[model samples]
Target: MNIEPTILDAVNKWLTPAFDAKTQEEVNELMTTAPKELEDSFYKDLEFGTGGMRGVMGVGDNRINKYTLGKNTQGLSNYLHEVFPNQEIKVVIAYDCRHNSDTLAKIVADVFSANGIKVYLFSELRPTPELSFALKHLKCQCGIVLTASHNPPEYNGYKVYWQDGGQIVPPEDAAIINAIEKLNYDQIKFAAQDNLIEYINTEIDNAFIKSSIENASFNTPQSAKDELEIVFTSLHGTSIKSIPAVLETAGYKNVHIVPEQAEPNGDFPTVKSPNPEEPEALTMALALAEKTNADIVVGTDPDCDRLGVAVRNNDGKMILLNGNQTMVLMTSFLLKEWKKAGKLNGKQFVGSTIVSTPMIMELASSYGVECKVGLTGFKWIAKMIKDFPELEFIGGGEESFGFMVGDAVRDKDAVAATLLICEVAAQAKAKGSSVYQELQQLYVENGFYKEYLVSLTKKGMEGLQEINQMMVDLRENPMKEINGQRVIMVEDYQSSTALNLLTQEVSDLTFPKSNVLIYYTEDGSKICARPSGTEPKIKFYISVNAAIENVSEITEAEAFLDQKIASIISEMQLK
Candidate 1:
């Protein structure tokens, strides 16, 4: 095959002495026989999004491999040098249990070392949140973790963090991207110099676990522990090692592990995807929970940052609580316990995303603690914590099954979440209330906040264009009513404007500009439309709330909420 000139040049460059021989042969084979695929692979560089770099694993400009990972690291290191020139620059690097993760971590360490930055590299696999916490605890200038998180087996990612221990945001994010964009084929440094890089091991691990236990909710009277039998799963990701240790160290006994899914593998052998938010991913754990007469089932993703739990409701059937429900349940339980222990000072507050369950806000307000809403990411929540130094952060969560308690880490920590949930379960046992019963009590106090998240994947260039067209159509012809409900207000975040459609008034939105549109109906229904930043998908978030007079009506309320969601989806043709 006659390859394109540009692709041929890229292949030749890969064959250079600076590049690995194995990578060179792979590129050569693709160039000689699969010219089209080669071009597609090397046509453009992988992008660093609002989070960080994520893509398919392969050797090319557009994929996640040693060379590309090196480039991203070099750029980040250069930016760190520029940002902290004349001062010591340090960074923490961690990786998950994915294929080549250890190698990638080593490569990143080499790049940081080559650039005159001190690197605190994890000696073994760790969760994404640990890296975030390490950034803060170690006082590093920046941090990186080689993890694809909940992505498919063939995918891997690199997340960049700032000194605040949150993922990089704003001017720094743009600056890092600018640095990454300037690299050419020959500019990235990939050579390894042994002394420049340092590998961190159990010292940090013990410290992190100690911190997890210190931050755990252990206020329950010691007598309550015997009644709690909790089942936990790691979903064949990174939590197989740490979650159990944290639970045992937190004084919770009788914890059962799902033996079938106990091992950590990048393929995520037992589940379709490592994401615990999906009920399908928790099938094995749920079954084990039922067999053991367990009170709850908790699972973490590959990187062990996000967590999902399935609880046996009053009906004795296992029901998976959505992300919103989980946060509401956890937050309400934590706050109640904190108050009981006399820890609810006036300065304590909670954080959640703008699209998370409104019940959190109501719960916080009723407790006389402020509830702050970030744009949509945990990093923003971390930023809020940094912004308000006077406020003591109780806990914060996103609806994606990610929650963080305590300020020990600036990001979500499933290990911390797991320990706390078990403690909460034990506390509930003392009160003769299961976690499910606590959820019902929360609804009795706060209004019922039902949420639905619908994601539509649109792949390739044409699919992206189609998604854009749908957004444009919606903007051009605004809807006045949906599913027989009148829309009272419309908020277009991309334009930073909110329209009072009823009064024909317009006002500027205070938040940063984003490609999101939100509609509020007269009947307390809220709908949000946002295009996914990292993937080929658009997500619709629906939140509907109503008063609940009694816990027995939860089933009818849930059914009513489901029907409402169905009508909205049908009216919007979102399927």
Candidate 2:
């Protein structure tokens, strides 16, 4: 294999004495046996995206390894020092059930300790949200979590969070990236300062559980909680203890666990992918739910930051609800409960992503609450919470099965979401209704909205180019129509501009610049295109809605919307 000079230089750097012996041996083996793999791994440094870095675990510059994590921690340490020069810097660290996650978490803590930063490291694996909560609870300047949320087994990630209990965003993200890029392998401090590292566990768990219960409690009837049968699966990750604990503490008595997936296993042997958004991942839990005649089936991703649920429909058949459906349920339920409890003042608000269904905004409007739209990730939602400290952040969610209740933890949290979702189910049951029935009622109250997401995975160097070309083509030649409907407006997030086709007037977008495009149709259809920041894929989110005068018409409306989405996909040649 003919290696490029740049790739060879990177490969040679790993072979030097600065790297460990095992990493050196792995690199040598790859050079001799798998030159293509070596090239792919050494071609470039692992990019630190807005939420930090995620990549395949291996022994190369582009891979997530001890060295890469070390360098990132050191850079973060430097930035913390620069920002808070006189104060004694402190950071909390957590890991999930991913391969080498525990080891990597230790390495991260070591590097931070070496930089003279006090480290509060979890004694065992925990959910990602707990890390965010610990950061703020402990009053630490920053925090880190080592787990690639729902990625494949071979992948792992490092996420950095600010004191605000949200993932790093904007100026801080750029600054951290710059600091990471300036460091060399030799500059990373690998030695640990044991005295500065403190192991913490039970104390934080108690506080987090207390906070979750307090935030989610809406005086849910105890009889309803007792009658609700909940089947929960952690998907072989960190939510094993916390999710069940929160439910039980909230007075839920009939909760069952999927035994096969209850334990933390990095391989995620039970599912193809640990992502709860995928239907297949919830198969085991669904089966268990059927056996137990459970009222609802819930599953969380590997990091416990996202949640997916399946509820029994009117036909007594279990059906999985998509991200939008769950968000609608949670948002609408929270708003209603708050109003019922006399908590809905003009100062309360909620948030969702641009790709999420517009029904949330309508629901918020009906309740006289403000609904803010962010770019995509939950970090943007958290940023909105931070930006508007005067207003009460009721709750927020994205179309990725991620929802956060209240402000206990700024990031998307499955623990609180799972508990609150069960509460919603309980109350519905008490009212002689089911979760699915309540969802249909929601559609009847606030026009039916159906959302679908299609992701095209583009792997390796060539695939990256193809993805970029696709975006360029869309931007250069905007579509005038889709599914025979005229494109009334086009919003280019990268350019921070929105164009109204009829009036040909352009308006500036206030959100941060991102590589995303949204097309609005004259018939109330919306399409969003954006590349995943954390994965090797481009995603298209389609949402179509119609007024539902009767709850019985939901099926017909859903079918019509599905066909509309299909036609749009076909017209755009996305198939």
Candidate 3:
């Protein structure tokens, strides 16, 4: 393989004595046997995007290694010192079950401690949301979690959280990235100050569990909780540390955990992908639910930031609810509860992402609560809470198998979400109705909306170029029709403008600039395309809606929407 001059310079730099002997040996071996891998790894530096940083673990400037993560930590420490001048800088650190997460967490702690910053490190693996809670609970200026979220086993990452208990956003993210870029590998502080580093466990765990139960509970009768049969799986992730305990403490007596997946393992042996959004990840949980005749099943990804759920349908079959379906059920139920308690005083709001189902807007409008939409990632939802503190945040989620109950934890908390979802199911069972039945009734009342997501993975340097080119083509060409439906509006987030197809008029959209495009059709169908910031993939989200006045029409409405989505995919040559 032919390598670029710049890439060859990077490779030679790694071969120098500046990198340790083992890293030098590893790079030399790759240069001899795997020239392509060597070129790919040195083509560009890993970017610290707006959503933190994630990449495969290997020896490269583009990979997640000690040098990369250490640089991030060192830069973060400097930024915190500058921001809180003359103050004692304190930062918390947490890690999940992914390979080397523990070691990575310690290295990060070492950097902070070595730089004269106080550090609070978790003694063992913990949920990502708990890290968010701990940062705020300890009054730390910043926090970090070492986990790749739901990505493949080969990947790992670092996510930085601020004092607001949310991921870094906007100006801070830019500032931190700038600091990281201005430094070299030798500037990272790897030495540790034992006195400045503290290992924390039970104190934060108890407080987090208590807050979870309090936020998730809705005054459901204890009798209903006792009757609700529950099945939960952590997918060999971190939620096993707290979810089951929280459920048991909250009056839930009949919780059945999948024994095979109860243990935390980084390999994620039982599933191809540890993500809860995949049906195969929940296969064992579903089987257990069937065997126990459970009312609901829940599964969490490796980081426990998101969740997947399955409920009993009317025909006695276990139906897996997609992320949007679960979001609808959770949001609508919360809105109803708030109304029942006369808490809908127009000073509250719900949150969602642009790629999520429009049903959230409908539900929020019907309840007279404002629906705030942002770009993808829960960080933006967290930003909503901080940017508008005057308005109370009830609850919010996106169509990615994640939800947050209340504002205690700025990020998504599957542990709290698990208990809240079960409460919904338990109450439905108490009223002689099931969650599926309530969902169908919701469709009957406020139109039926179906959402579908398609992600195409493109790996390596060449693949990244291909993904970017595809986005450029879509942005410039602008599809005029799909499945015989007329495209009426084109919203380009990169340009922060909306163009009307028929009138040829342009207007500004109130959204942050990004490489995302949305096409709206006359039939109320919305299609969105955006590339993954942290992964080598591009995602397309499709949403179609139609009115349904009776429960019996659900089956037909769903089939029609499914057909429509399929046709749109084919017409757009997505396959």
Q: List the residue pairs that clash in candidate 2.
A: none
Every candidate's CA RMSD: 2.3, 1.0, 0.9
Off by over 4 Å in 1: 1-21, 31-44, 341-346
What lDDT tens digits, residue by residue, belong to model 1 across residues 402-465? 8998888888889988888887778777877788888888888898889999999996556678
Model 3 scores a TM of 0.99
Q: Work out candidate 1's RMSD over C-alphas.
A: 2.3
Which has the higher TM-score value, candidate number 1 or candidate number 2? 2
Clash total of candidate 1:
0
**Per the 3 Å backbone cut-off, how many clashing residue pairs does candidate 3 have?**
0
Q: So what's the TM-score on candidate 2?
A: 0.99
- lDDT (0-100) at residue 388 of candidate 2? 94
True lDDT of residue 48, candidate 1:
71
Writing each residue's lDDT as its tens digit, candidate 3 over 527-567 gives: 99999988888899999998999988888988999999999
What TM-score would every model get versus the actual structure? Answer: 0.95, 0.99, 0.99
After superposition, candidate 3 runs with Cα above 4 Å error: none
